[model samples]
Target: MKTEHRIRVLMVAAENGALPAAKVGGMGDVLRDLAPELAKAQVQADQIMPAYGRFHRHPHASQLARLTVPFGGRHEIVTLYQLANPAHPESRLFLLDHPLFSNAGDGVIYHCNDPEPYASDASKFALFCAAVAVALCQRHLSRPEVLHLHDWHAALLTVLRAFDPRYQPLQALRCVYSIHNLAHQGTRPFRNSHSSFGRWFPELAASLTDAQTRRIEDPSYPQCLNPMRAAINLADKVHLVSPSYASEVLQPSDHRHGIWGGEGLEQDLNRRHQQGGLCGILNGLVYPDTPAPPQSFEALLNAMHTTLLGWQGHGTHLRNVDFIAHTRLQLWQQAKRPPPSMLLTTVARLTEQKVAILCHRLDNGDTVLETLLRRFKQRQPQGLYVCLGSGNHTIEAELQRVAAHHDNFLFLNGYQEQLSAQLYRQGQLFMMPSSFEPCGISQLMAMREGQPCLVHAVGGLRDTVVDNQTGYWFEGDSLEQQGLALLARFDELLEAFGSDDWQRVAANAKEQRFGWQSPCRLYRHSLYLE
Candidate 1:
């Protein structure tokens, strides 16, 4: 009898957000943690990402191989580099290099010249996914038994595999596509100059002839090529990052109140789910093995001071925690408010999902946060709030305005990993009031650091946190009601901080199993190895 080969996986990630990443976000964190866990389970997990130009300037990636691949009816040589993954020896990361993807500039990964009828982003990602397919199909370096892809960026793998004869070997490879967020469906018209994807991926075009779009699409609408739709139609397995979101996305679009239910791919998702092709896997946390003992307020301040001194040694005397502690002193030379006792931290994107409809235009007026601060001050006047991370420039400006006026609020507009870590370790609470979180990492990070999270029960938050057991949650029917509920929970926690019951909850959260062990075991047994 012939012996079966070892299970190997190739995870194609557009933004694998590992350590050298400018700023680590949720997806990057997940892939970083997960690759190793799968590897530990004896599955070789190799991740491939675009060797973005921003990182190219730095000598981080070492060139591994160079090969020519066909693109835009011609061919170009693409270089492959191996990125270091210190956590997993068996696991590897290959970075695809090409001028269009590399020279696209810093911080921005996806470039779109147009929004309708397909943006130039179409060409960029097509090149990326197509190049990845060709490189791996030819090299067979990893000898992948499974081809795994994340988001719409890598969905083109299915299209490439379906069309190109060079990708015949990939047809025999089991394909798994994971959707971290369903809001972004790469919908573009069939024809475009930059991509000309139909010409390149003719097999997919051939399938569209038999595509029963009217059956799945709205009768009033014409067929527009949706890449996510293509992936769902073509991939062997499809999964959401969280179970609640899996069920939510499977609901009829009309029933999907205010949430993005696969962004017009609901019908397809439902069909796929019924056919047993869809699932939800709660993303696990990358918690440090070392437990953080309960700390004191002085220790928090000392850490800030130490970090500040390190900055001073480098010849700069900027402010951080100290500024919030003495916001009035900067403006008036005297402390207006006795150092606000409570320290609350929120590190997230200032997007609609996070701010929940509170994200607004700055030109319109003061943001919802200004109003929230006004109301919060009326009852709980003494507290220090630190808002970190920036997105939606309007929200960033509004937050700056609030921080400028109030002695209690400090808005740090950037990604500073060290500062975020110190704050999470020291803060009394971490806040994540996302409207629809697939699976939140900040809350898990906060809980692991011994800071209890006060979150709205949704997506991963619902799965990970037990109300009043692991952390506090606020649930309501409407946004306004949810806001009220959040305040109520915050007030309860604030009033009872440093008490025995509060300590018990914090301890319980600390003891919670947020790590990758269980989740990886499931993948090994139920998905990958099986």
Candidate 2:
């Protein structure tokens, strides 16, 4: 008899499957990319999630099992769906289907209802934890050696395993709790967990009460222990998204002003560090299966020019524009008019972290964009600009106004993955001027499409974007300086790359791999898997 060798990893996350259905930021993209890579890497990784309403059911998404999950003194019979791949047949994803929780349009994870009563919100995730425990006990799948949990949404698994013998056998199980962001700690009243678990684990009531009292009186005892805090407190190993973010959280800082953490979370971090906790890993992305290096500036510009001029072929145009209208449709059409003579794109959530505000001309309420906008209005504009994504309503409106005023500017209000890939392939350059970033996927994806990144030199951007080699990097966050620098770099690229010198840089950018191969290897090593 031959023994089969496979490492089963149960990856617990709030969101997966598709984008925009429930994604607020990069975490959705991370899981989507990582899941496929895990399969390719030969790890039998299965994802466990609440079947938010957004999840479109496939034929294979069958009702695998059923169980009465306890929630707030009531038991709800939750149907668990097993979405299996037809090719693999055996590989499956477990989805907990509960109308109370899963009815979020497409069955996806929603950010916590902070002020609203998702009356059954806690119960919803609690049921997920219970389902995982039951799933293990029933042997529906092979026992996983690792229960990898992401963010506070799934932190309860760590907490439950620590106290409940029903989960104690898994105590020997190695748990890796990934903290995507530290800000959204799932802090509920300690009494909620106490009361919720009272019937299940009566012995913890006294401890919970004491903790609650201390939490109330101190106001600093980490009120209610959200997933981020709980996972850090309980997991055998803890990991942050990036190395720099790991350092940043320990020493808190004000937005763009300076480091403010003289005595913030430093003490807490030191205490944890002393106790043999805390690690950081840079997030990785799956490189697209497309080869799109620029042969020459003229070729690149010609393709872009065609796309701008409503030309749809010659490898420069998108598959379709209707799909790209997920953001701001009217604005997208306006910007796509007259076909841009030149095409430059910056697609990201309009947030301060992205430093998109810097792109706006602040002087005379006329931004650096004013010049770009003016160029678009000219009979022969230098380029057409396409900015996709939604964030700060003020910024969205401002960009919309800029697009409305200019003939060659398109602004999308939200995310559309296919359109983004199309734009990535078509655009000449992908610009990101984030003030600070942990590990940006956009730049890596852009590079994969043979589009060089133009970014401010900071954080992960600095780590990825090589100056004058792979892409352009600006010094400061100043709008005028960065804008001119970006334009200058692009023009220089045009002049230099009109020859063959650009090929080396393009090849270098393309060759710089950001795939799961190396990162997954690093993760395996970190977890003592050779």
Candidate 3:
């Protein structure tokens, strides 16, 4: 294919096929949406991901090639698979398959042990980077004019391209590295693998002494030399998931809490930008069907209206207080362990960043549920607490136990795409107490579904949720405040559902359109493709 005939773009993503059959985090959602959208825009885009066992592969998928990827004085044979995009069957996708990396029991990628199947994860990715360069050099497939790297796992490709002469000839090819979440930088001890930089920078192994290696693995910012940071230093342009979030990282300003483990790294990031590197690219969701609210929201609203209004055909009144009350009651009844008179939904990872623990955890080390349950126990609590998604086994287990003990609480351990859409529609308000967020899609989807978001004012959350307008925005990092705010608004929302004010907010949220068309255009502009 002629270079000009197709806007050849290759996206290197770490979380694309992650969790296979299970929809895990936001990154996978991005990959799922982006490639197909870009293809629709006439951009010939393809994704490269590890062939995970969890992935349901298509039979016609072609095995592209086989090569031994060197890692820490050892070589692992990797098989490359090619398939047209299932989402947009016309678009292409490349899967890098390695027996050692993915051929574990269930074909999941978590095969780390001993020398760590992926222990040299950084090195493993380094091999992938080298392979990408080699592939580009050989011109065995489509020549990508833009190499898009997502998060830190793929950042190494930018570093390798900085020096790989084979790819240097494609000087027109611009490197775009996106910081999905700067906190999870892929940094580890650089084992002296022959096919690795040890062959080029022999002193690399010496530099990473025992002490230094240990420090890098530390979760602390000082101990980490994130490859994402290195990519920022090398790539022509660095992008964040959202414009507002882009602004947040520029200043953590004590407001960011919980989820922000690598706090000061943004300071260093700003310094790098001063030298001319970083930029913000707001994350966008694909509106594949109808560009309308998911059916789940409509169904939930109908039930609420019918229960509260008594005279309802459909809750035509924008903010019908009675309708909201009815809705809450219905939801409460459906909740496994309903609360006294209110039901709140929080669907996110059960981590501190997600504020799952903070909101649910009690001073006695039990959970907020115990406190709420205790208060409502005498009243046969009308409220329900439903949690969807998984993280931190301890947190997940605790949440499950709470659900089991309390009829008001319901815990869904894994992610369900349709269920997520339903939650956005059915839930009165979406809660995200993340210490810091890089433009969360859940909140955006909630708003679009006419469900208000009650989020902490940090990163993307700060940018999207308008305080008192769209939903609620808490300034502090405290989950207690978040839970309180939801409770405080509960009665008002129910009493004045048809109120013009609340309706305006829901309408505004519904109108807030985020699609890949504009973002893809930005990519074209950034790369000067037009």
Candidate 4:
């Protein structure tokens, strides 16, 4: 059978970093994969992102065009450069460059050099959104039938096109706004909008004068631009990154699943859900073509096993228990023992939302790592855990403290991309205990490398992992309970992982498909098919 007819769709995002070439992660990964995949399926797919001032400092990015982008009551000169897809050169990437985004000095992308919000983030993204809007309105760029915007950074495009008469050319265009994470709504008060709307966004602001004239009604802005709010109200459709997360965040306010209430935007989301405009689509993982798969499965397992054997003083527990187990026993007698044979790897930032889940406590007075340690200690004499990432100094300090007391635990407190890749290849197991994950790429990457994951059954993990098949899932309301459940699931994995069983499971895990085929269909149907 042939693929369905495809429509031209343009995607706008803030920082378009995808993997090796790197920008703000997750969302970048999605667009990089999805755009090319759509192109293959016959969609005339193209993307636009800001060319931060420093984008070309290190690597060679292809050039497309250089032009000024008008926004926020002023005109800024933006060079539109091109990045050709290695696989599909027909697919287009227009990078809009500006000094602020480039410098790491004025404003960086949403990744925020720090976990906390930068003081000028609202202004930076506002400028980006406005630039994209004006570019389309002025007809300086060709308008696609559909415009796909990612997260809050690109939300205002839909807002501008919907409300501003000058953007009339884009008024009829279908828009898709995807919310990767609801926690960040890009909210700063109305007083923070363009200082000179009369001079800069003259016609655009005037279009907002009459409440009855605007398609999306919101009196909350000009006081504060909740880009997300406008996107939800104006975009043709909105979606989350995973089905489970979509369901959880859609429940009524008093419901347990709706505890966080989509960062208190549930009312709008509930309406969108009722109108069939809100849902979730699990993200696709594009396995790199550059690094070909290993020749044999045994080669992969042997590599991991060799890494295990090379662990410095980490011991193993066995009934025979004569060698390393003996060493662990000696250490135990001196109260310096650690987990004996278990090895788990984590490659997430040390923030509460991610890696810190290993050690952070919930209101229930229970911490994931603390509870996991209790259960793990009961099963083994000493285990090795390697964590790689950095962000949030408090979490970093806590992880260091845990490493200091546990001889087998090592924390590498910064990002090393190649080292991260190596760890994924050799790690016996991968762990992701995120508090709330929109969509996680690490677990998918680990599985692609034939390593099973241990993730909480939430968000993307729920959609990705098949319990007892590709990997195991543990879910609970509180972090402590989740940790206990994680330990329980791990024990089950340990039981099922015999010499032959493990190979079968690893193969099954690798067999899991993580491409854009399914999700792109959803987008095509929602945004273009009508």
Q: Across residues 404-520, which tens digit of lDDT does each residue of candidate 2 receive?
A: 666566665566665566677777667786756667778888887777877767556777778878887876435455656655554565456434656677667777876677666
Could you report the Cα RMSD, in angstroms, for every candidate shown?
4.8, 6.9, 9.0, 7.5
Q: Model 2, residue 77: what's the lDDT? A: 74
Runs of candidate 2 exceeding 4 Å displacement: 1-5, 18-25, 39-42, 54-56, 85-90, 111-127, 137-141, 164-166, 187-224, 256-276, 288-339, 359-380, 391-395, 475-504, 528-530
Where does candidate 1 stray beyond 4 Å? 1-5, 22-24, 54-61, 106-120, 193-208, 212-223, 252-260, 292-339, 357-368
* lDDT of prediction 3: 0.61
Count clashes in each candidate, considering only residues at least 3 apart in sequence or on different chains: 0, 20, 23, 17
TM-score top scorer: 1
* Reference-based lDDT, residue 294, model 2: 30
Candidate 1 per-residue lDDT over residues 1-530, each given as its tens digit? 87434578888877765646533468777877777887666677888877766554445567877767677656777777786654475677777777767434654565533444446666667778878887877773567888888887788788777655777788988888888877666665554434555545545455544444432222223445566777887888887887888887875443123344555777788898999888888898776666657565555444544544554454455544335434433442233434456678898877667876343323336444565565556556786677777666666666666687775676666555666777787777888888778788888888887778988787888888889898998886655566667766766776787789899988998888767787777665556644
Candidate 3 lDDT score at position 393:
63
TM-scores, one per candidate: 0.84, 0.75, 0.76, 0.80
Tell me the lDDT of candidate 2.
0.61
**Which segments of model 4 are wrong by more than 4 Å?**
1-6, 18-20, 56-72, 106-108, 111-118, 192-223, 252-261, 288-341, 362-366, 374-382, 491-504
Which lDDT values do the candidates have, in the order given?
0.69, 0.61, 0.61, 0.66
Better of 1 and 2 by TM-score: 1
Q: 1 or 3, which is superior by TM-score? A: 1
